[model samples]
Target: MSDAISAASLLMAVVAILYGAWYQEIMHAIKITVPKHDKQINFMVVHNVLVSRCLPLTIMAAIVFLVFLPDVIEILQHALSVLGEMGVKSYRKYDSVRTAFCLVVFVSFIIAMHLCRLTRALMEVRRKLK
Candidate 1:
């Protein structure tokens, strides 16, 4: 189960990086010297910035989850065990870590969905402009 979770997390990170790079390249290729209306140009810039920020953050979050969370949780569980025998205290500590892990996972999923939507929107706009 841990192996599967690790694999999935790694895959998600890679996909996020690839999508970000592809989107950036596509946006860059769309640069044409038409007399830019401020509004349209501003919209494009803002969209690009938002996508850039979100993609990297999403990727980073996934990497942290994949590489750090498991080990950290294990260490934490061990530390908590010293405080008391393996019962309520240990379970509570583990539960806290689990909750944090879940939150990170949920956020990553949301960001992934948003990135997908943003990519689609960008592609559509690029098509229309062309």
Candidate 2:
């Protein structure tokens, strides 16, 4: 079960990196750089370096979330046991609890990220409107 979670997490990380690299601010950061003299090949700084940092910030947010996993697991385990007591014998299995926990955490993380992005975008749009 842990192996599956780890595999899925790894796959998600790879996909996130690929997707985020091309995503709004990161893509702009990669393409735009401080202008260097055309005649001389000089080093150029990123145009908006903060935009590039968003990827690392997002990854860090995910890592920070790992701290809560154990608590979530505990709650899920309890819920599973309770469900079993309530006559839902199918959820009583140890593996079932772990799998359900993984699914819940994965979905929660995805939702949180999307909501954050949506909020940031709305704020940006509001600022532009001002």
- Which prediction has the highest lDDT against the true structure? 1
State in Å the error of residue 17, model 2: 19
Please write out the lDDT profile of model 1 over residues 5-52, one tens digit for every residue.
Answer: 465456556766765666665455344333445446645654564456
- The segments of candidate 2 whose C-alpha lies over 4 angstroms from its true place after superposition are 1-23, 30-52, 88-108, 111-130
**What is the C-alpha local distance difference test score of each model?**
0.55, 0.51
Model 1, position 13, has a per-residue lDDT of 66
Stretch of 10 with least lDDT, candidate 1: 29-38
Q: Which pairs of residues collide in model 1?
A: none
In model 2, what are the clashing residue pairs, if there are any?
none
